[model samples]
Target: MRIIAHRGASHAEPENTAAAFDAALVEGADGIELDLQLSRDGEVVVFHDATLARLGLRRARIRDHDWSDLAGLDVGRWFAGQATPHRMLRLTDVLAGWGGRTHLYLEIKHAEGRRGRDRHRELAERTAEAVRAAGLIDQVSILSFHEAALEAVHALVPTLALVRNVQRVGLLTRAAQQRAGLSALCVAVDRFGAAQRARLAALERPVYVYTCDTPAQFRRACDLDATAVISNGPAAARRWFAGQTSA
Candidate 1:
């Protein structure tokens, strides 16, 4: 099974920062997962939330700021023990830097309503364009909770592969998966079990579980025969897996 770093070893480093990705590699992760959002000026940036409130900037949203404005912000200051501040990265930059080092899973943040759909399409297009430009068509997978975004990506980059992050297992119908051309399905670690695993397996695609930060979650993922399990601390997960194997 592949051990992918959730937000790139995010437990020790600020999520989505280059440092976090570096840490993930050092921790022996097989792949790295990151989030993508559009900047006000039309740049595809690597960020998770719609707002900067987590960074202590209230009422400040990611889409409200231009890339130039967002690039200067110290995104790492909010994380404990992050001695150095990190800046937000653009998809162009991330692709250029980490394209072939390891597999990547790029998630488009969830959004709702008609306006959100428009934004999703734009993000999907831009993200797919960037990945194509970087020559990572075989190494990266575009993911989104919104099937529309996945559909947009499928239309733009038919061979790039797509992943759908489903909230409720039943919400992911065979037709929806077929429509998105999903290469895989991802679920929150807590939501997957033997029954759910069998149900997802019927699609005949790999199953990925996310935010597997704890040993139990990681173990459960393995038990469910996950193709890959995402976690915030790759090193710890490795140790846990090693212990299980040696026992």
Candidate 2:
């Protein structure tokens, strides 16, 4: 199974920061997973939450401000470390810097309760441009829980690999796979059962699990033949997987 760093070794560094991603690479993670949101000026920035309040800064919406404004905020204080202050990262920076070295899983955050046809399209256009500019269009796979957002991304870059991220396993997932032309399934490892694993296996596509920080969860992912295991601690997962492979 592949070990993907969730938010770039978040257990060690602030989530979604360049330093965190660099640490993940230094620790030899197989993949790096991150979330994307569009700024006011249509820049695709890598960040998890919509607000900056959790980072001990003002409660400002990332989408409401441009990248220049958001970049000035300290995004690292939310983590346990006292010395680290995270700078907002651009999606283009990650692709150009780390695309060839590690697998990139881009999760597009949906603008919930907001209605506009072009909003998703704008995000998709910026994401596509960045991926293409960095020559990572083939290497990176874009994913989203919202089907509409995924559709917008697919329209922008049809050849880009897409994954359907869902909470539960059911017809919705199956339908998403069919409708989105998704190449992989990313699910919560605990929600996957024998039947679901078998079903996904039969489809001949990869199945990935998210936020697997424990050894037992890693074992379950291995047993289920998961293609990728996303976790906050990539080093721990790497050691466990290496041991499994050697055993």
Candidate 3:
């Protein structure tokens, strides 16, 4: 199974910052997972929340402020430790920092209705453009909880793979991916079992699980036939994979 770093080895470093990404790479993660939002200046930035409040900034949303203001906020410090005084990083900066060294699974948080469909579409295009311009397009795939956002990206970059993030797993993810022709499905690790894995596998597609941290859970995921699993402790996954290789 592929081991993905949840928010860049977030258990060890700050989530979604350069330090976290570096930590993930050092921890032997196969890929890094990070969230994306649009800045007021139309730039794609890496962050998890709709607001900057969690990062200790006075602003509520990254979209509400221009890059000039957003740039000034210390996004790293709130996590404490090495992430102290973290800087809000541009998506471009992230791509530049870990472009060749790591594979990126980018989750777009900007949804339609809230941000409008057109704006979401534009965000998709802008993100794809940046990835292409950075020559890292092939190394990244897009994911989102918003169906429309994923659709927008699918329409723009049909060749690029998209993953569906379902909140309540039923047939929703399967249906969404079937309709959109998405490349992968990301479900909560606990929501799936062997039967579900077989069903998804029967369709000749891959399944991914999120935020599983322990070796036992990882082993369970493998038994469930997950194609990939995301975790904050990527080092644990690395050890598991090494064991498998040796076995």
Candidate 4:
């Protein structure tokens, strides 16, 4: 099973920063996953949360601020004993820095509410452009929980790989997969069982489970023959897998 760094080895470094991404590569992750949202100026920024409060900054929606304003916030300070300070990273920064070196799982974060749905097309357009500019469209998979968001991306970049991210496996999830022409499915590790794994494998589409950090979970992913395992502790996962293989 492939080990994909969830938010760039987030357990070791602040999520969605350049440092974290670089660290994931150094730790031998097969790919890196990140979250994307639009800045006030229409730029694609790499961040997970809709607000900045989690990073110890004033509570503000990421979409409400310009990139310049977002960049000034010291995102690294929240993590204790961080070796170096990290700022927010742009989608371009990640693509340019580590695009071709490894696969990228880019999750398009939904906008704050109902009104944000209107910008899905523009988000898809911009994300497509960025991937094209990096010349890594083939190595990137666009992921979203919202079917409309994935549809928008497919319309913009038909050849790009798409994955339907679902918390649970069910009929609706299966329907979304067919409707979006998804290349793969990213399901929560706990919810994906042998039955679901067999079902997806039979369909010839890979199943990638997310947020797996413990050795037991990593082992389970391998035993289930998951296409990939997304984890916050890539280094630890790599170590465990290495031991398993060597043993």
Candidate 5:
């Protein structure tokens, strides 16, 4: 199974930063997953939250600030044992730095309090443009919890891969996935099991479980025959996978 770094080896480095992405590649992850949010100036920034509270900065909506304003924030200092400061990264920067080195699972984060379908469509368009500009469309797969976002992306880039990130496996989720022509299904680790795996397998789409950080969850992912396992501890997951292969 493929091992994808959730937020780019986030357990070792600041989530969604360049350092985390680079570290994931060094640790032998098959791919890196990162979140994307649009700034006030319409720049697609690589970040996880709509707010900066977790990074120890004054709580401010990411969409309310321009990329320039958000860029200077020190995001890494809050992590335990991390002395060096790390700035927020733009999607363009990440694409330039590690575009072709590994597959990208780019998730479009739904902006809180944002209404209407236009916003999601615009995000999909901008993200698609960035991927095309980097010439890494083939290596990038777009994922989102909002079906509208995936639909917009599919309409914009028919050939680009799309993954539906669902919290549960149900008829509604399955119908949406089928309608969107999604390339994969990313479900929460807790929601996945033998029956769910078999059902998804029958659909012929790869199942990628998310945010698995512990050894037992990694092993459970393997037992389910997941097509890929997304985890914060990419280094540990890589080590485990290597051991399994050699065993």
Candidate 6:
């Protein structure tokens, strides 16, 4: 199975930063997985959380701030040996720099609260526009736990691959699959089981397992026939997989 760096080799570098992405590429990762959050100004920025508390700013949300306000914020201090501070990256920046270098699995998170549902369509539209502008439609796949967001993106670009981030095996329904024109299944290592495998097989979609950081998890992914394995430590995971194969 192909090894993808989850949040770009996040175990070593700050999650979602350019530094982490660069490290992942150097480690010979097959792809990079990242999260997308829309700034107030409609810029799709690379970040995993909606709030800034984990990164040091208290009681602040990414959607509440414009790109100008969010830029230059230190995003790396929380990570070990990241005292130098790394700023957030925009989707455009990643596309311009890393596009075609490796596959990108960009996850679009659902906005908070009930009213946030309306905003998901906006995020999808902007994300679709950015990807089309980048001209890397073949190299990227948009992933999301929210079906509405996935469907919204699909409506904009029919050919772009959309992968549903499966929360549980039971949620893998035919209607959801048909609506999003899903190309694959991204299942967490915990929730994957015989039922999920059967459903995905029935749908004839490829399986991509996430956060496989342990040797046991890597072995399990192979047994489950994962097309790709996403992890925080791509370099270590690659070594473990290679060791298992050679043995």
Per-model C-alpha lDDT, please? Answer: 0.84, 0.80, 0.79, 0.83, 0.82, 0.85
**Per-candidate clashes, comma-separated:** 0, 0, 3, 0, 0, 0
| Ranking of models by lDDT | 6, 1, 4, 5, 2, 3
Which residue pairs in candidate 2 collide?
A: none
Candidate 2 stretches greater than 4 Å from native: none
Model 3 Cα shift for residue 65 (angstroms) = 0.8
Any runs in candidate 6 off by more than 4 Å, and if so which? Answer: 174-176, 194-196
lDDT of 3: 0.79
lDDT of 1 at 162: 86
Give the poorly placed runs of model 1, Cα more than 4 Å off.
111-114, 174-176
Task: Assess the local accuracy of residue 202 in candidate 4 as a C-alpha lDDT between 0 and 100.
Answer: 66
Give one digit per residue, the lDDT tens place, for model 1 in 135-162. 8999998888877788888888899888
In TM-score terms, candidate 3 sits at 0.89
TM-scores of the candidates are 0.94, 0.91, 0.89, 0.92, 0.93, 0.94
lDDT of 5 by residue, 28-109 (tens): 8999999998888888988888788887656688878998898888878777788788998888888888888889989998
Q: Relative to the unseen true structure, what is the C-alpha lDDT of residue 219 in candidate 5, on a scale of 0 to 100?
A: 74
